[model samples]
Target: MKKCRASSRILLIGAGVSGIAAATRLLQNKFGNVQILEAEKRIGGRINTIPFGDNVIDMGAQWCHGEQRNCVYEMVKDLDLLDFTGDFFSGVRMVRSNKEVIPLELGQQLYGIADMSVPKGSNAEAESVGSHLAEHYWQEIESQLPQVDRALATEALECFSRHESSILASDNLFEVSGRLHLEYEKCSGDQLLNWRDKGYARFLRLLMKVCEDEPEELGALEGCVLLGKKVVKIEFIDPDKVRVVCEDGDAFDVDHVICTVSLGVLQEQHERMFSPPLPAEKVNAIRSLQLGTVDKMFLEYEKQPFPDDFVGFFCLWREEDLKQLRCSDFAWLEGISGIHKIKHQPRLLLVWIGGPHGRRVELLSDKRVLEGLQWLFCTFLRFDVPPPQNFFRSKWFANPNFRGSYSYRTTRADELDTGPSDLASPVMGGDGYPRLLFAGEATSQSHFSTVHGATEAGFREADRLIKYYESCKTNR
Candidate 1:
């Protein structure tokens, strides 16, 4: 078994968290010939951390979603890499587009209602999260609030929906499947655990076993990964062998291939990239599952405007205001749900944008984005805000490598009865062995759209191969 495993060649496509995790586990299990081919010049797929302003900022993933059962938290908890400062919604200041400051208590109250209104578990009666939330939240507002406050609460609900849209990576909550949304199990403990100055790249370092004091290096997983190796095609050359071709004309024939690319990449390239084509079910699953775009714009000011404790300003645009501004050039600015303070970088503000607008913003000039922000702050916060010294925004949607930020279940997925499980299933070769395996955050059944989910998915695929080899040994 040891000889067989050592002699086998395994190729992992993409150097994201999933690919790295798979490589780490395979190497640990004595799969000596394992190699990772990354599309981009750098590793850490969507977990990109770059130097900005005074300290580092995570352009991709910034938080450890949970503590208990979270692979990222468990990996770095003892190392003191986690920060639990500032509640996500505690310091929320809801200001309407008309510059009316809603009472803190009222804002919190409406937000709480909206939060709880989202259906949980698989038995939800509503088809979509938006439908369930809309019916429930409006009911609560009508019953609980005064006539005057009801209209304001309705606007607040729209703000809450936009925030939810960013979180779910959906254009609108109406498209999100109510039952499938509940399928994602939340880990116990702090949900928005920050990495502070360290950023999410630390997780990649930890996965590679890179020491904190030492200069950041890939360590054991150093030579195993080849960057700028965009996998153009994956074909089963024979029953026991697979061929992976790269954009640079590099090719490798391996015993097995583990595909850890993003669902967005799969959706875009699966048809043309795979030889003999993927199964009908697999294709349907890819089409059904949506990869939503959630983009962030970071602005660094020379002088910080808000207090140290100020978390964010939730922008609630009234229906009438939206109607008037619908035809404006800066209409896409309406997609910005909130402008929040970055925890470690106090001088920086993080703007959350989602859906088609997120993609639209990416194509706009930086000057235009700044101008839009100026209009937004002046309108919502009633301030003539000066332009920031530094501005950085994520282009995940525009980036071919990652078509969007993450995956989310949609009503169509529910209707089609296709999901991560269907996408995660392997393509068995004629030799009765799994020749091509899938692993990513999208492949995670209960933990999709999370770093922990991607980690677990990688481990699952690696374990599957390990188990297959073990069974072969036993049979022998």
Candidate 2:
């Protein structure tokens, strides 16, 4: 453990995962004065879990990606709260638009081909994933795929592309970085872990528990969180002090401030949220890195419709569906990634949608969403199915606080990966001391967009402050 004697009152903006982590660590390090201000009423920002019929459902972030290898997993595994939901089955059943079921391997094979279409190195004329795949793999697909299967392959690839784009919460493949694109860092173990009935928000509880267990002299993590306190402006008062003003007219004066607002929030409010304006480099970085939306729908069934063996169903767009898309201009249902059967709960299904479609669907009423689901089931199930008993749709994009789901690598940030690093940098005062620091999932280079990324970023900034104080003591 690192020790520092420098006494400074710290203020944390945003009660998200990053803010929580930073607060806990600072308290454990014997920081006497620290407080967290949250825009939302709740402590967990993106981690929201709500009660449903008999079981609980996670409406926000559900999975702990990278399983045991994830820092978050290590922190929560012993809590006896998580259920490992890695692929229990080898693959899912591929359902064509014509209600025909084919071997799952075929769909995987075609998706593999499409994924390999982009070459290893950057091209002078960067192209979107959709365009690159069409240009380079169209001929190969035509020759390799049977004439009857060509259309199905095309539809499958389209769904795959949209899913990939949504994972980064990007608007489209075109906007994503084509040159040296940022790729999610994958751990060696299973890539996903479900939190059973406990929900992902339990991680916040665990964090609080750790803080409470600290020695009394180290300062408890108590009385540090203030919700519904939207920060309006942050200003450097002097080399050693900063003032934070909230929308509610509450103001806090602190020796240091850590801003852990999301990239989406930063993109929307960075200019107005800071006083004296952030440096040009920081502003450009905030504007360049895009924030994207990936929304989810939970459909509850009174009676289970599909077989227990069925894991999920992917929609293979038909010519008629394509025509309907042209006619309605809102046939995003055709791009449905899949309706996943929630493990352990046979009556619940999870559907994930991304990009424009995800945002559009969020506006639809439960009745309207159920109608779309009915059409989808009737079209793909080859039989009539009862309407879902309950329905839930996430509107992360519309939420003023969130603005969007997560960060993405944009073409504007392709030339340099400095965007994230710059966003993470501390704001310096005339005395050469950092009065403000920024952290979030977007600030992490390798782990951006993951829960672990946010946690690690918080630890990084906390450690930086600790080291700064340690250096000051030594120099004295």
Candidate 3:
């Protein structure tokens, strides 16, 4: 009664935190065969850090993001990555209307806005950050900082706009649920989320360490991690076997496949790449998910022109500038708001935006980005923080593999089922077994905008697959 077990491989796509997390589990559990395939030349997806000036510059996912048992934090701690101490709430110096600088403390009047919620009530369901902030903010703030006294009101609205729109500007904050909005709103709320000294990019290195611990099974193989190899198509030959083809005309056979690509990539590029086509449910998840872009227009200053007491500053724009950046072609991001800081000693500025503002930046010209920066400095400092002698900003969406930065949403917050594991929850075969899977931050909707979400999503999927495979072994 001796029967042989058929051996098959598992294919993992994308090399971001999620991909690495899944791979770590596969190798750790001694899974017979698990390989990761990355479309880009580098393994790390969004965690990019480089030596800018004398300090390390984080191009993506710098914050630990909403603390509380995050996988990224755990992994980094295991690796002995360094952490720094700063006043999460106090180190902020805010820029306001009438070109005045202030602190971020919640004013008594602002507290009313804080407690205020949707028209239905504070406990209402579904709305966007913009609409929510606009609705409650004006009610409480205007009485205190009247429109006749435009400076404080303008600055308060600008700060709120900067915070709210930075996620998903297109989100109808008004329609969003009160509970979910307050939850995320508090996470990234006015209080600071401390900066890291070890740098977020090091977490990727630690994952690489885990994956490299054993080379025999899942190590970087010829068939796995095909750089310059854009994954174009995937076909499930049958339930127990799936085949993946690359743009360069390469094909792979695996027992099952996991897709960890960005939401934006899945949105526009999914149909062209996957074979037999992903079902409407999966496709809908992709379309429904929002991929936010938090671009940093970094500039290095030679002197301490701005205040030195804080690490950064937020800016407001002229009504005209706001109108200008809003043009579909202009993206009106510069008009909405921005952040300013320094590279260690020399001053620096990062005019950031997410949601509608972010997509608008992509449409803007470099001259426009530069102009936006200038506007930020002029508005806040009232003194032009001269254009950086050196500067750089991210264009993550343009990349075919990453269509944009990590995913998050204002309107979609109430939905908890969108976590990245859903992507990997076994696309069913005819007999009800699994076929293809999905895992990524976009899937990790609640934790969408950070490094930990991706890693946790990856680990969750890997464990699931290992359990699935173990069950198969037991059945035989």
Kindly report the root-mean-square deviation of model 2 from the true structure over all alpha carbons. Answer: 3.9
TM-score for every candidate vs. truth? 0.96, 0.90, 0.81
Candidate 3 regions with alpha-carbon error over 4 angstroms: 1-6, 78-85, 88-91, 94-98, 102-126, 142-151, 167-179, 182-197, 210-224, 318-336, 342-347, 363-368, 409-424, 430-432, 471-476
Model 2 misplaced stretches (Cα beyond 4 Å): 1-6, 67-69, 78-80, 118-128, 139-148, 179-183, 210-220, 415-418, 472-476
- 317 in model 2: Cα distance from truth in Å? 1.2
Model 3 TM: 0.81
What is the C-alpha local distance difference test score of each model?
Answer: 0.87, 0.75, 0.60
- lDDT by residue (1-476, candidate 1, tens digit) is 22367778999998999999999998998786999999899999999999997799998888899888888888888988889964655887998889988888888888988887888775463579999999888877767764646667788889899999999999999999986656888898888998878899989998899988888678879889898889999998888889999998999999899999888999999989999799988898999999999999999999777665556799888888888777899989878978888777878888999898999989999999999888888888755568899899999989998899999998998888899999999999875688999999999999999999999999999999898786444221
Q: Name the runs in model 1 displaced over 4 angstroms.
A: 1-3, 86-88, 122-125, 146-148, 471-476
Per-residue C-alpha lDDT of model 3 across residues 94-191, encoded as one tens digit per residue: 55534765545543234235335233345444455446666766666656545334554565455555555454333334433343443332233222
- Cα distance off (Å), candidate 1, residue 359: 0.6
Assess the local accuracy of residue 161 in candidate 3 as a C-alpha lDDT between 0 and 100: 51
